[model samples]
Target: MSTIASLSRSWSSRVPAKRRDPRCAEPIDVREKRYGYFPKMFVHRGHRYEVYAVERCWTVSRRGRRDRIERHCFRVRCLEGTFELYQDVRHNTWHLQRQVD
Candidate 1:
């Protein structure tokens, strides 16, 4: 098989590929932790990455009687790789964004 075809086949096989040497990281139960608003899918390079995401939202009260502001946060973890917090976006009273390393 050609390299491209092999790569495609390997990618389509969504099972977690073996790591040459695996290391342990702290286990995170995103569902229990953040209430399930984070994106469950991620893409890396030209392939899809299986990931678990945690999303949190809180409100900041405005002074006196003004309307409160809502803050949205996303925490994403790659099931096979590593990542970091990237950016946040606000739409009206909520936020939406992506995280990467």
Candidate 2:
């Protein structure tokens, strides 16, 4: 999230971008904490990351060719490291955006 985006007064006004990671859509198994909204485990690139903690989460949207695209992004900590994962709510897809550590 950009500084200005992070400072949004309300969740409805927040603007979100995919940060520095290259965009790729890959299928993964996710263990959900609640209604599959919160991630408890993440698997990608043949490596399974157990999400020990979810630091933060939010949703952002952008205009798409077909419809308004919404993404659910989670900043989480796992056995390996901290990472940002964003899920496309409209398409039911997930992207591994970047690693914080």
TM-score of each: 0.29, 0.69
How does each model score on lDDT? 0.40, 0.76
Error of 1 at 85 (Å): 4.0
Best by lDDT: 2
> Which stretches in model 1 have alpha-carbon errors above 4 Å?
1-36, 53-71, 91-101
Candidate 1 lDDT over residue span 1-101, tens digit each:
99999998887685343321122221222222233444455444445655564433333333335544343434456665444322223332221232333
Give the alpha carbon lDDT tens digit for every residue of 1-101 in model 2.
78777676455444344352246445666755555478887778888888878899998888879889898888999888998888888878777877778
Q: Measured by TM-score, how close is model 1 to the native structure?
A: 0.29
Off by over 4 Å in 2: 1-27, 31-35
* Candidate 1 colliding pairs: none
> RMSD per prediction, one decimal?
16.4, 7.5
Give me the displacement of residue 78 in model 2, in angstroms: 0.5
